[model samples]
Target chain A: MSLLRKGQQWGTFACVWHIFDATWQDPFRSAHLIKKYLMGLYKPIYHPLNQCGDHVIVINSKEIALRGDQWQKRVYFHHTGYHGGATWTLAWELHSKDPTMIMKKAIYSAMDGTLQRRFTMQRLHIFPDDNVPKEILENVSNQIKQLRPVPNRLHEIPQEERDKIPRLIQYPSDYQLK
Target chain B: MAALYRVLNYLGKNVVLTAQNRNISLSAVTRIKEIIQKKEGNTLTFEAVIKPDPYEGRFLKPKNGACAICSSGLDIKHTDVLILSQFVTSEGNILPRRITGLCETQQKRISSLILMAQYAGLMLRRSPKGGLLHPLQKRKWKKFNSYYDEKTIKARYK
Candidate 1:
């Protein structure tokens, strides 16, 4: 495997490609992580406009998880440039309408505005699902892991396996655990 | 014969001409159109002029050059149409080249620019539309807004 600096920049001239998979992860947190990488914060030679950022590919955005009541509290507003064209939609509604919007917005907002900011943003790629085209996928040199692992669902645990666990304590005769 | 002569005298010049041209059979008023044209000559009407086509049976070809932004020398990053809106749909998928009407090179450029914008939080990736609520989510905030008489939420954050 080549070193980060060598692989990212070909003799200090070319940009590197960095692909990521974000399936079943919180979009807010993942976006933050992506923004850091985008600015080359991790590199010692990081600068504002040297074009040091690597290309990032994100997949399975549809499975993004939102913590707590953010879905209800968050709202996006827009206008149609006409009389009474103002519209407001809840976070969840927008997610259903476009699965990849949140992550893209989060990443876009996190980066600082600079001369290279626009060029940097173009390196980021996001998909709602894992249906990326083969031509694009071929350029992926590495994968950025999710910040947190998604917890397994209750249904995913088999009934026979659940029954095998030992009981910690017995309930009182008059008290009902149910 | 005497009655016919009286009728001809009443009809005057037209009758006299008809009688003179009896061998030719019908009067000018009731004569066949072809016979009338043959007699009057075909000089009254103009013939259709046939001109050569400029395009030679071919339609105007579509431009297969660089996209509007690239051709105009305006960077894709500065253009919201390519970065924040036009290139991507509300559902967060990249619009196809056919719909965007961009040439292959420009389409590729815009696609990269969009990804860059997304990475920088200049454009949205995930849907702004949130998921379904459990009816109890953010209940306190909702009630607080109602009690405070804050009906319009426009420009609240701005």
Candidate 2:
């Protein structure tokens, strides 16, 4: 009952701005959300041809997750249309080089193959971190909830709680976790 | 016309060559004789002087100096002016300059800015009710009902 209280308004609005925090969420899930929001599928006024999609701002794209084994097994293929131009890159390596590349590609391929797909894709904004411009921040009217809550960093946990957790063995007296 | 030009050309050449000699041709003196002689091949006739196109040289200046939105010192990214403006339709179609009262450049800027705003989560793009067609274009039940009435229904059933 409490979860239903925060349900988004589903009415057809002329314009809406949405923000998403990509931290620790699956990149595929984030891409799906971005595609859905960009096409404005959640609204009643959504039409395949109509440019009724809303804009979505995605921050912390660098921290997006991949399902187990995908990071090592997934390979992105590319060719430069020249001799010996074919290249294969592992997912983790590609993500490290350009944090937004995977998500961008996911959303790009997910959209319908129409001329308007290019235009709709323009509505997705991705940032590697939380540092969005002040002007863009001011315009964000809504937040798209993440599929999972962000895990707390070790430093954020209370000192007493850390000490209370039982361990099979203790490190040397000189050892420092930091 | 060629003969006349030839005559004028020869006469000038002869005059330059025979400046000391006054032995000029009688045909050259008579203007009627020059007009009567016709050249064997095509003779150059009327050549009309063409006027240059008026609009060709003119550059269009936007009505009040620079673009309307730019002149007002409103930064598209920082300000909500574009989002607040009614220049864009619910389906993200930009209104024409006539309705928006903006110059051509500004209209383009507004459109791009609106798109940017939409992507940045600052604005919404929505479609009008019942798509682009007007309500009047929709067929009235009485008008369209006849097509699907008894005769057609019977034909399909049969």
Q: Per-prediction fnat values?
A: 0.00, 0.00
Off by over 4 Å in 1: A1-14, A173-178, B1-158
Model 1 per-residue lDDT tens digits across residues A1-178: 4698576565344455567677546776777888877766766567775557777888987667564346677888899999999999877778878878878888887777667777878888889878999988888776787776543322244666544433212222222111
Off by over 4 Å in 2: A1-11, A153-156, A162-178, B1-158
- TM-score for chain B of all predictions: 0.35, 0.32
In model 2, the Cα lDDT at residue B8 comes to 100
Task: Kindly report the docking quality category of candidate 2.
Answer: incorrect
Q: For candidate 2, lDDT tens digit of each residue in A44-142?
A: 767898778988998988777665346667799999999999999987778878888987888898887898999998888889889999998898889
lDDT per model vs. reference: 0.56, 0.58
lDDT of 1: 0.56
**Shift in Å, residue A21, candidate 1:** 2.8
The root-mean-square deviation over C-alpha atoms between each candidate and the true structure, in angstroms, is: 30.9, 32.2
